[model samples]
Target: MAKQALGPIRRSFAPWDDPEAKPLIHFRGVTKRYGDFTAVDGIDLPIYEREFHALLGPSGCGKTTLMRMLAGFEEPTEGDVLLDGASLKGVPPYRRPVNMMFQSYALFPHMSVEKNVAFGLKQDGMAKSEIADRVAEMLTLVRLQDFAKRKPHQLSGGQRQRVALARSLAKKPRVLLLDEPLGALDKKLREATQFELTDLQVDLGMTFLIVTHDQEEAMTVADRIAVMDQGVIRQVATPAEIYEQPASRYVADFIGDINILEGRLEKGANGISRLVVPEDGLVVETDQPVESDAQNAWYAIRPEKLRVSLDQPADIAVNTVSGEIWDIAYLGDVSIYHVKLDNGTIMRATTANTTRLVERPISWDDRVWLTWDRNAGVVLTS
Candidate 1:
């Protein structure tokens, strides 16, 4: 099924850009250490109210550790975790106004869907009638009202995941923490569920903090992403900013398929700079250049931005290179061409397969010219 866009409401939501906006959740110099190893280094971050934030990184990168600290499962070795202007120090997990949904779904084997969703309310000593009402509301919200009587084992993986989500939302926590919520689903199901999850979040108007290692998952569902590496946050920005104008090479390479070539910077007028990559025999131009006195820099461009053509480019002075197609990968909707340049550098280019494969113009071992506009790439001095 096709999905609708988040529209102007979410598109215009940028409370972080407002100076007077107070953060709903704040990590003030937070750190977590395990004997000889540091899991989460000293860090400061803020999550706004009703915002969908993602902590994205590889394994052992402290994304989970940081989320655990926020959920009150682990105490911060150094700083404090604050929620709504109050310190959460010594607050127990169950007592705090936060709910966590684990990756495994963690549903009870014998309990029905309704029972699982109503369990938390019952634990808090809510009335039986109120629990029933809340469970029904939650089931309807997750579109599982008809399956309320089914056991966890009776439901499919996607259905079980929805039950877990309903249970997590039953108590209505101020902030919902999801630890790799969709990691168990198949690729197609996971991609479809990403849109559904986004829609659900928008409907509830709740603050969601999801910890994920999948870059595409983070990019698709998060309002902002914090890229972590070695217990340190490398960069935090919107998906477009993170992809188009990464603060460092690590972030640029970590988020997507980008070609980063080492080069020496040559300054030019009007904020344009030329990067002479001697080792790759290429000269790339970037329209956006930050104030950096370092002469050595890196030029980064995504595969989708590079255009592949059989004829030589009109302007070969910059942002153009001649290469031979070493390999081609047809990915249904698009094709990836691995073009080996004259200097033996494998540059990848992505082209949309708008027509049938039989009508394709470029083929294997074909000599091609790759070109991009001056503004298509970014210059990184780090």
Candidate 2:
């Protein structure tokens, strides 16, 4: 059997928007401690049905530890975990209604793909006919039916990873836990498999909770992401929300490249943020409102938002800065200009390579003006 191309996705899923959506998995003040060290500290979160949630963070950030608690591999030291309204306390890993796929693929080199996929069903004491049928179904779902006879060594890295995925899905667990599932594949294959995984998850209507340190991977496939750090949950939101409206300075820096400038909020009209960076001689206006009591604010602007030109534009009231182009990075698809101001502050502006030929584009050591719209970036208090 082979996977048939699915029709266009009729509707997008957004369960978090519904007020009545109950959580399929809930972490109720969950905390895990090993000796004197605490890995997860009082985390309360929920995962709705059919939601592809991601636990994203850097290494040693306790993301894996939190996922392990849900997998029943580790028990919480303080709070409890619930799966579909039932407490998962003291439940063994094998008995839980969950399955985990490891990062290494963990395929048996000697076994064929069919046998590897059927291994889990066989372990559950399923009849031979049922095991075969389940294995076939899983192979078809993962688009690996033709490679069922091949051993792990004979298959490509992507194929072997699919075999592991097929085996994991053979059991039809309510929730699938993936621990860095695509860590081994090369970049191209990894990106390809990400879409495949998303489509398959939608096709099967499975709730997948993945743990990964890669920011792009988490953002690409997940409906919502939980960004964790130092045994604490920092921000949990949709990919676009997290990227465009990061909660803190740590989150903004962690997710992508950002240029932060020290600024103070000045009194302005309603719904307008007036920022004065005395150090850099910059007056910035942003769409987001600033409170009168708030102080010690910083302006976080992405490089792509800033437009650079050789001459000053007429619309300087929005936001503008004059500087000399210090450097340029031609990245084929985009060119980044590093502008150095008189106040010894360096800022970056990214311009896309839209034209086939560059006709008098700004170059290194050229006097340039940087401009951005008021709504291009939001004012960040933290």
Candidate 3:
């Protein structure tokens, strides 16, 4: 199903770039160890107020350990965790001004939706009237006010997740930590909920830190994503920057479908750099400055950025490769074509299917030329 229409996902908040803006949460040289295994390496990270930050990594990459540290469930072996300029060293999970929503809904199956949302408020010794008011507000915020009387078993997965969200937000915590909150939902619901989560975070003006292995979910909802691997952060940037200008080869391949070519950078006559790959005898001129002293580089290009043509273009010196169509996967919106070079290396390219039911422009075993602009590829040294 197509995604539900939602508000623009542009990043309206950029506190990280502002020098005067104070960090709402700071992890100073944070490290966590379980027995002899290091879960989180010594790393420093700061999250700004009211920003939706995502910790994205594969399983066993320490993303959850970081989130647990923030929520006070697990303490870091080294460094201090400061929330709003105050240390959260000894604060218990319940005492800390943060709420967490686990992958499981954790809703009360026997209780009504309203009661489930009001449970935390009542635990704080809030008056009955205030508890009702907060519960009503949270339900309305999650669009579940009409189902306040329904039990957890009576609602759908999405609804139950919303109830869990309402409960987590009812206490008005300083930050909300989510651990794979949408992992229980189906694909369509998960995609729709991503927009809703972003909208809710913006509407509530609350700080949200989510731990997720889903790359597309992070790109859709977060203002910034910290890509982690092997107990250390690889790169932290906006979704576009992280996808387009990956800091390393691992990050480029992890974020999306990427085609990487092992190449060598030749000495430049002017400021422009030239990288040559001997496998396909391809040389590309790039305006991007290469460091004076560097070795072992690779060219990274997204499949969508490459253009395929029936004949070779004039610019054979750079960014041009002709290969036979080795494979083709025709997705509804776009077609992925695998072009095999002379060196038996297959490179993937995607073309948009703009017309409905048109003749196949290019077919299997047809020779085609693939080319990209000078700046279309990123040079990765590490």
Candidate 4:
């Protein structure tokens, strides 16, 4: 199947950047506490309409608690949640204009797909004909029209998830809350379904707020991700920004595989900065200026940003390190080389497997040079 066109929406949509633009949902000083433990701290967040946002963190980080507050399932111990300019302080879950699709799917075993989808409308006392038409529309929207007569047990995991999504969308909610909705699927299916969910969210033009611990899933589907830790939001940014320009050491380490070398910053001439690692006698130069006043800092570089080669780079004054290739992981698309530097620090370099060769040119225990551009890594101070 052809991929859906989602680039325009992803690239051009920036309502949060506009001062005049109003958000559909606002979380002002929202805090949820159980006994003495704080699940969610005082947070102020704004989710724009038609935006696909994600609340991502590790277990017990309060990502789910924040989502529950928005869904009206749990009231905040302090602060408030507003949807479309209306406060949702005392609103019940059922009365909220948002629907939640749980990880379990919560499908009825005895009811058919169409009947399961119509359950919400029927509870609202909609006419029979209207409910039938809405069910048909939802089934078609999820491409489950052919399985309308099948029960939940008769469908595959992906199909069952679609049914759950269909039922949730049958209400035409203002916002859709997904709590690890694709957790049941295997790796390959989960990847494919991520695209499907993104396409579906765009097609419906409804706001989506998903909570998940899967970093790749959030990076793939969400327009913006709010990374939380210990009930506090660490950073909120687009996927590219989050990956390329992480705000802190925690965020830099959490999102992906990164090599952090602690060193002291030395300001150089002409917009040049150097990170001097005294322990390793390594001097890393960069074109980017250091904004922080702290001399003690860390230079964070992703594994893929480093270049591995047997030959020493022409310029060895900076951004060049010699190491022995201790290990190599041959993944299908790429190979990761774990090189042990002279200072006993192990850094990884990734190379794409572009051609099929019976024997590899690079192997273990080989003396190699890892080089990177001056602008390849970011200087982080925290």
Q: Against the hidden true structure, what lDDT does model 3 obtain?
A: 0.90
Question: What ordering of candidates by lDDT runs from best to worst?
Answer: 4, 1, 3, 2
Off by over 4 Å in 2: 1-12, 358-360
lDDT, each prediction: 0.91, 0.86, 0.90, 0.92
* Best model number under TM-score: 4
* Model 2 root mean square deviation, Cα atoms: 2.3
Query: Could you tell me which residue pairs clash in candidate 3?
Result: none
lDDT of 1 by residue, 58-151 (tens): 9999999999998999999999999998999999998999999989989988899999999999989999999999999999888899999999
How would you encode candidate 3's per-residue C-alpha lDDT over 112-203 as one tens digit per residue? 99999999898899999989888998998888999999999999989999999999999999999999999999999999999889878877
- Please provide, for model 2 over 11-32, each residue's C-alpha lDDT reduced to its tens digit, 9 standing for 90 to 100: 4567778889889999999999
**Best by the lDDT measure:** 4
Candidate 1: regions farther than 4 A off: 1-5
Worst 10 residues of 2 by lDDT: 1-10
Worst lDDT window (10 residues) for model 3?
Answer: 1-10
Cα TM-score of candidate 1: 0.95
Each prediction's RMSD over C-alphas, in Å, is 2.1, 2.3, 2.8, 1.6
